[model samples]
Target: MTVSPATASAPLARTPLDRRVEPDLRVALCAAICVGLALLWWVRGGWIFPLDDAYITLHNARVLIEGHDPNYGVPALVGASSLIHLSLVTAFSLVLPGEAAAYLVAGIGPVLFLAGLLTLAQRLSLPWPEGIALALAGLASGTGQFLNGLETGLVMAAVTWTLVLALDRPSRLLALICGLLPFLRPELGLLSLILMTRQTWSRLAAGSDRAAALRAVAADAALALAAASPWLLWNLAATGALLPRTMAAKQAFFGHPPGSLPASVVYAAAMTAGGIGPAAAALLFLGRDGPGPALLWFVSLFILGFALTNREVLAHNGYRYTFALLPIALFAVMRLGAARGPSVLRLLILAQWAVALAVAVAAPTEIAAQQERVAQYRAVAHWAQANLPQARLLIHDAGVIATASDLPLTDLVGLKSPDSIADHRRWTAPSNGAERFRALDAIARRSGVTHAIILDDAPDHFWASLADDLRRGGWSLDPIETGSARGPYILYRLAPPTDPAAK
Candidate 1:
């Protein structure tokens, strides 16, 4: 057979897949680096419980495993932020002690997150060096939350893989992941919505058959609904609400401040810049034909959502809410660098690795700082547990101390109480602190609360007012001195009013 010139050149015209280099060795090397960093974090600070919020999940898990309502004594309230995460921790707690299971899950989370990033990079078919660098960058970006035991790492991994799969092609797995997202974190469902919308649009734009596109959309919807129905039904039955109480509480507490929208956008843009620097800008502006739209959509939606609802909360906790952007930014860099040349890719990879390495090295210090903040709370919890074992306590930071103390607690912030949320809504004005505290005091008295634990540096004005009210209103304000590194938490002993008519 005669070989034509066109046919010979066709091989060179083949897609990038034909030119793609094997990434297994690079994947292994990246995985090894990630594992080493994870191990360093584990050895240094992984075991220390840094966030009080984590204990709320742990406590709920225990309650569920023991066949009670997940909200401890609050039978009808759905307090946990992530039902799926709580269920997973609950399953682990069944085999191990609750605290141990919580720590173990948190400890293993970063390792899995790192592995997921490398897998994603390999899936994207970047050069091995770039893949390793991206994974390292992801590791560095998430170090704080990975050590703190929040669902941030798990959600980040899930979002990365789901986006990868959905962008590559729509499938039943994508649908299933979409369904499970809300259970992981309610806001994560937004990611699923974005992916689904993008996939549907892509299918239609590609001139695929209408019937096929319809079928794909239908399947995605059905599977997502199936995966999410149980949680949705449970929430409806338990809380008579579509979302958890925690969501409402957060929304109420951190509703968009007037004129802050522009500032919020600036803050989010700044965060994206800090995470990926000029590379992200280059990818967005220069690589418009690539993943720019998707990246831009994700980042913009995330920023707007938080800005309108809880940008301050996002700002707190080391910018964990924005952690998903790290992987997205890395993906953009990979695409941009590959289009540019190997030299550009190498430089980007090196820069990413340096950032990641610095974060990994500083993991211990971050953990220690977090530990110091919670030290006073831990001491107070221990003291309360030992001395006032039967006293029902009113607590502002309701997770760790309440869990550790094993006392009946009225959570003023409402993570574990439905009534507290209702009360907060009734007292939304800035001037209502005195009235709110008075109402809270009444509620506490009705609930038989004999003591209150208040943090000295609590930023909430209502909490500060409550403390002052207790001091002047006949409650004995005794500051318990702890040798803890963090100082000044008060343990107030509630005393009955001197006159019966005063009540």
Candidate 2:
């Protein structure tokens, strides 16, 4: 393959403070370098920092690994499911157990995601180095909630590549895989359907075989429906609708007195940009495309629609929920820089990598610095995992607690209520309000939750309300030990005996 001049200098340019190397091994070289950088980021800040939503996925895997049915409480709530992680749990269950398997799975998921994305770019006729650059761009951008510890990165990569392959060949096997996309992430699956529908409509308008297009559409839809059947069935049984997993959380948030569109917009913007810079920049540059600019317009509208509807902005920000549109964003960027020489394109790509590396390196210690004030909350999480019987403990902040403790959280308060479970499918914090708190307490009691976890950051928040309720119910707050600068986390255990004299 002939290398473009612009692409050649990208990795070779010397920075005064940063090391640089020109890639020569083509795909292998580019991929290896990118993987090395990701590893550096993962090791430097991510390894110890705890992935935002990784704990929930890890918890689910742990359940299966431990020979227990991996129930993250979605079955009884609003009816949502994650077959991809469930499958991982089953695979890990065969040999590895507990945190051992969970960590491996968690770490590998992102790599797979990056690979799948590169595969998709290849299908689009992008050269290997270009594809690698795009994949790295996706990772660094943090769009689609890459930094959220949600499995969106991998899941999106899988779904996007699946669609690309499906479109290129439209094979039964590829179609089948494409159909199962919804099983990995429902929102992305729905987005796939929408994009396919648009494509099919265009084909029909162009005088292609209508019957064939109809068949293709039907096949795709059937596969999607079949893949989603588990959740649909669960929802029918639980909530009487094929709604989000946490329908209760959604109702609670929407019904809040102060909640409205303006608030959602604020949350959405924060989610779109919070901590993840490259992805955000890609999204902003999506308009710089072709003669018709059809793809650009389509993606922009798609994301804008999602933002308008998205309610609760999650902790990992809005990475997962918005990840479905990232491929289009990347494609747009690729096209924008296509006119520039290859070296310049590679340089831009290298710059993105540099930024991601800098951000990740700074994140760990910066986050550690703030851990002291949040120590009490982390301590309680540790105590709950150690002392209390682990029968589906419910927590407000799934990432902060579940990832740190390597414990499974049964129910997250606001996962489906506009926050999108793509981050922490098993756990999410409730939106602000008195009703939200009451709902959290009610769910804890009804679901037979063994323990409740709380942080003192917000007095009127769900954690505070749960603490007050537990205290009234005669529960004692015990301190738990933790690592690093994390403060004392208070575990609210149900009081032992009514009579102190009995002891």
Candidate 3:
């Protein structure tokens, strides 16, 4: 008797065709377990360490909430990217509370980032369990310091969502969001856009319908223009240039006689190794046969390129700007799953997560300690606010002091804008520390720049000179010890000197 076609095509081995899903389910469950472990490790660590640039972000948000320009309290070393991102979070926080805003950002950033990448993985035809596992690995690799009490997670979430948009839909609304990336952190955003747009255009070109391609391009352009309008309009109103605050920070920090080439390279290297292991970084760029290796490559390239191009010296506090391009870490993990087999990829991803967890634990607990210093400025800012009527205060340290106090702000650090200072000597040369002190004193006397508060722990060069000048001028310095406050800080009251020169 001849076997029927259906009987001849019977299910292989033991399981019936209808119930052949056990293997996939088992793989998926295992993947879920791996991913869950990594996420658990991350959330276990509450938001700690305000980080190097976190103070700047927090200051910007608080300043906006206090009815000051977002630029107020912006440190000399920070970029406007952080200020812009935090300003939006501040808007949310304003309706709620600062801590509420912080929690919202901490929770929402990861959720949004994970959701977007999962959607993109679906679009790429990755298996659901496999996609989640890869995405989780990518998350662990990219978000090494994500749990920190700052806006880095928000920025990374935005970038991840941006990539998802680029891959899955390529809609104009997504493009608008993508355009906003550069404003948050130009280097990462710009590079990512270049790669994403190129890939998008390539896909569009391959499509049979010319009309569809044209619409996609038009949509991208429209969204980009709309999202970028604020930066351009703000520049026109403030500095008459499309670039606000970014150029100023660059010129001040990297575009000096020494330049910031070494610093840029170091930052790039640190970023590559920061979230995922260095091996992951290498695989991201080198992995050619991965499912979405092109996307991962672009993500990594943009992140690394933007970081290095900034060319600024590494801040001692931490490289907080690295947060902006952190999505590449997630992308790298996804590539690992695609290029290597799922089982091998699972082991590698777990190892990467373990690295991130280790680093997370090793990081110091005193991350947000600077909140105390910010408190110091709050104590004295009241006196300045009541007595002096200036819209902005130039502080020696752009800590919580600037943010806690309801004052528009500037920094004397010469990191934000080298040209803000009349004398180039102070910024370029070490002796300019004395000149800066004298200049601050002169400004206080002439411009009614009410206060020149200094931190006892701040750099000796500038703080010492300012203190000396205040003393010599007979300006009585009233010190408020921090023990009387909620956090660490000092309040100095500068009164007009009995002798004019003594001030």
**Which candidate tops TM-score?**
1
RMSD after CA superposition, every candidate: 5.5, 8.4, 8.3
| Count of clashing pairs, candidate 3 | 14
* Cα lDDT of model 3 by residue, 1-503, tens digit: 11111111121233253135534543554456446545744674433234334545555566555644444433222334543556666777777666445555555556566666665554444445666665665555444345555556667677776656554434566666766766665554565466446646665867799887877787777777788787667645644445545444433323332336556555656654553464345344434432245555555564445454442332333455554545655555554444454665467556766775665555534434553444444656665556555545545565454445556554554434333444323432334233344544554565444455565554434344556665654566676443445432345556766666742
Q: Flag the better candidate by TM-score, 2 or 3.
A: 3
Encode model 1's per-residue lDDT on 285-392: one tens digit a residue: 324543357557766787777766655566556666666666666666666655565676678767766766776687778777667767767787888788877777
Candidates ranked, most accurate by lDDT first:
1, 3, 2
| Local accuracy of candidate 2 as per-residue lDDT tens digits, 114-135 | 6655654443434556767767
Better of 2 and 3 by lDDT: 3
* Per-prediction tally of clashes: 0, 19, 14
Cα displacement (angstroms), candidate 2, residue 303, comes to 4.2
Task: For model 1, state the Cα shift of residue 327 in Å.
Answer: 1.8
Which regions of candidate 2 deviate over 4 angstroms? 1-53, 62-81, 116-134, 141-149, 159-163, 166-174, 202-217, 220-244, 247-270, 273-320, 339-354, 364-394, 397-437, 440-451, 457-488, 493-503
